[model samples]
Target: MTETLRASAPPVATGAGAIAVLRDLASYVDARAEAFSARSSWLVAAATHLAGEPVVVVAHEDGQVVGLAALSVTRHRGTARVTLLGGELNDYGQLHHDGPRAARALAGALVDWLRAQRRWSLDLTQLAPEDPALAALVRLLPGAVVSPGAPMPRIEGVGTSYRVKRDRRRKATGAFNAAGRDGLRAEKLVLDDLAGLERWLPALVEVRRARDHASGRRSQLDDPGVLAFHTSVVRGAVAAGAGVVHVMLVEDEVAGFVTVLVDGDTHRLYDGRVAERWLAYRGGTVCDIEAVLRAQDDPGVHTFDWLRGWTEAKFGNAEVVRAGLHASSHPSVDRLDRWEATARRRLKAALPDAAVRRIVSR
Candidate 1:
């Protein structure tokens, strides 16, 4: 007999009860090596709390949880929009499923359920281009608008060595030399540095705030919730052996920091910050090159992901593209989203490279 799979957004009690369920579901589906962000219980827990009125949809087969999707429901101008949880913090938003068959089933059930809801429109954003759920949604809802999100640049085949281009390598070497001359040294932060992380977190926030201010842009670190979420994630991920933090110090003073998530053979550069004053010493570039070199030395690491964005300085040697995905149920919303996307592309194309970078980096 074929396994019967059913998807439902079961009501969950607020606070502790919801957290437990989210953790359980994350652990259940996180067994796969490629689960990355989806498998992070701490991230899920943070997202659930951060997303106002969270709705968790799970697919059950033979009474076992086989797939799950977390969403945030918010009303805007009498129209309710359901978005993937975690907001801008999430690099990719996709359903966690056991297999392709289960994925299709889960997607169908989810679309059907969303359709039956009141004043609701589905908005799936920042999904991987090849995410099964994206294809499933397109097939299920022909009227849904699909658009491109930011580009994800990654360096493949990092197990034995890195594949930096000649010019980029020379530039990195120059930065490293400059950093050494400036008395800057790079070091990895270990589990014992949990307390040290507490001190460093604020410094990183300050660095980011300073940089953003200099560029006339708003920093997400200004938000207490984003700050708290990252603090929770870094602590939890480091304790779980799923992440590491690398820092550049100049004679006991922190100059820059980078956080990375390790998943099987892949090392994802999640976030980083460099003090504005240290820019002249090329502290940020030096720290990043050091981190990449360390990842290359790790026998278990085969790929280094720069995450979302396309920057020549950092991702000039990117071997693969991890495109983001988006879809909307409302026709007007879909058209508007597409228009915005098109406008962004056109503007990017018309502006100078440096101006484009400033616009996107803001």
Candidate 2:
């Protein structure tokens, strides 16, 4: 396939203009009937909220929308980042097409466009090492580096066989029991029966903030765009039977919260946070346990994945039955060989390469 690069064209990218493009994106995704990253309603919602001064690029072949990707340019620390926005949204997402070289072409076009912006660097965190789509990225962007984002653990799932490891099951059960003895409790709340949306949003954000404080991490809920996306898209998921929010609470206060996308019989764990003080209770890890088990309990729901991870917490743990991430993102040539090697070398220089390799390998 020949490469066709197109920058974010304006006529189709204004606030109202993007709607049609976004709709096209959604339609292109559905046309595949293939599980896709850009297809998630929640992600689209998040993008719609955060896509300020952003660029939307589309790839075409013989007049058909073969592939597309969005770049949200957000100003951070006096610099603008062409972020792929892979959070609760698309951490484990891959190229949206199965056609020959379509994924690679899409990725290459995006990287070439980003380089045109004349930015200091392009940041793509937590892309799976062997993704074919990224194969073209290194060639396009010669100085890019790949690094781990947040550490999100997941269970392995195959064609029709996906299960959490025995050790993880044992430890999760033990953690649940131990925490339970200390007055820690976690219940997956179904807001289906809740009175109305007026009250849920506030409690929702508050619970998330508390959980993040407990986990010693920032709360995504505190972000206006993220919270708004949840409120808007979650309603749609519930209506479609593909959306459910799992609230993990310790007693009366909210310990942690996760908003999951129940697409058919499978559930993709999306955005989440754990209260900081609850770290002693393994709030984040255990919260994942509680959410995953709840998803598994439903006969309609069979799989749960914590989108992406480069940290040791989720990726290298037993909780992951399978371990891979969104295989998108372009890294420079040297960094491609050891995508995370530099970071590992500097921070973990004291340790042996093998030991650091396990922790840093995505």
Candidate 3:
């Protein structure tokens, strides 16, 4: 076994230097089967439009970069708060690293550096439960508040259970039959035209919005900033051939689309939107199943990750369910954030879906 030689650098402010480090780390992570969220393109896209100051720490061994963590720092009433970079944008958070060993070393180095800093609060969310970094942090920080996060569902090849496979087949068949009966031609394609993509993106969002509105739920792509960030990510991914927009057209009209990010042998289901009118025909599910079928046929793809969310649509194809982590440590802010989150959840539950949507819209 090679002995680990660890050296940590001072926090680098967000800029070209930080981006370069992220790119290097992303390349390292991408070469392995690491989370797609940790890929270079996603990190760069998220870092470019950070909501707070970024503090990037790079770790090295034998003068070679091994791992890094990008953090966002914000101040409220003179109290500094730190969070994982692009926490909102990521489905899983882990320090970008070479592998498990590098992950452990980098996590230790990061914890040491953070301990040396002045008074500040740390809130790390969307952390993968088995992530070595997360394990190290939980072990080192005793008083940290650790919470169970959302479940991320994923499909392993076809499906593990007969029920799941049956559901998927039923949906796929019924959807296609419905389209045929309605005289609507349906086709799914790997969209590569940049100009056409630019035009269709807004329409996609609108379709998503309409679907959500019909369901009396709030849309994730409602914010302009969020839309802009997604655009950057989509464009970057498509340009590099690491991503593809699978569009499902019905009778020459847009019915639905899914944005997929390919990392190594895994194809992540990043974001999707379906026309409200096409919901009766399971347009969204058809688009997703089409991607899943294509991925299953590919010799390279081993996993179809639905990233995060436990929607019924994901369950039909999902064979595994993974959970994320949320941990927080602070002298003054401990438990407050968690309390607020709980309150928000309760309030959302108590209100009607349409009322909740109205509140979110305003």
Best by TM-score: 3
The order of the candidates by TM-score, greatest first, is 3, 1, 2
Better of 1 and 2 by lDDT: 1
Candidate 2 structure quality by residue, lDDT tens digits, 6-118:
22323225344544465546645555532334453534665677545545565665655566655456654333455554433555444455454777767766766665555
Judged by whole-model lDDT over C-alpha atoms, candidate 1 comes out at 0.65
What lDDT does candidate 1 reach at residue 310? 73
Task: List, residue by residue over 291-362, the lDDT tens digit for candidate 3.
Answer: 777677777777778876677777534443333433334545645656877998898789987787676555
RMSD in Å for all candidates: 5.4, 8.6, 4.4
Off by over 4 Å in 3: 1-11, 15-17, 23-33, 61-64, 98-105, 116-119, 145-148, 157-167, 183-187, 192-196, 213-217, 315-331, 342-353
Which whole-number lDDT from 0 to 100 does residue 241 have in model 2?
A: 57
Candidate 2: where are CA atoms >4 Å away?
Answer: 1-16, 31-37, 75-80, 85-89, 126-128, 146-152, 157-188, 192-199, 214-218, 248-257, 271-290, 299-302, 309-362
CA lDDT for candidate 3: 0.69
Q: Could you tell me the TM-score of candidate 2?
A: 0.63
For candidate 2, which ten residues in a row score worst on lDDT? 1-10
* All candidates: TM-score: 0.79, 0.63, 0.80
All candidates in order of lDDT, best leading: 3, 1, 2
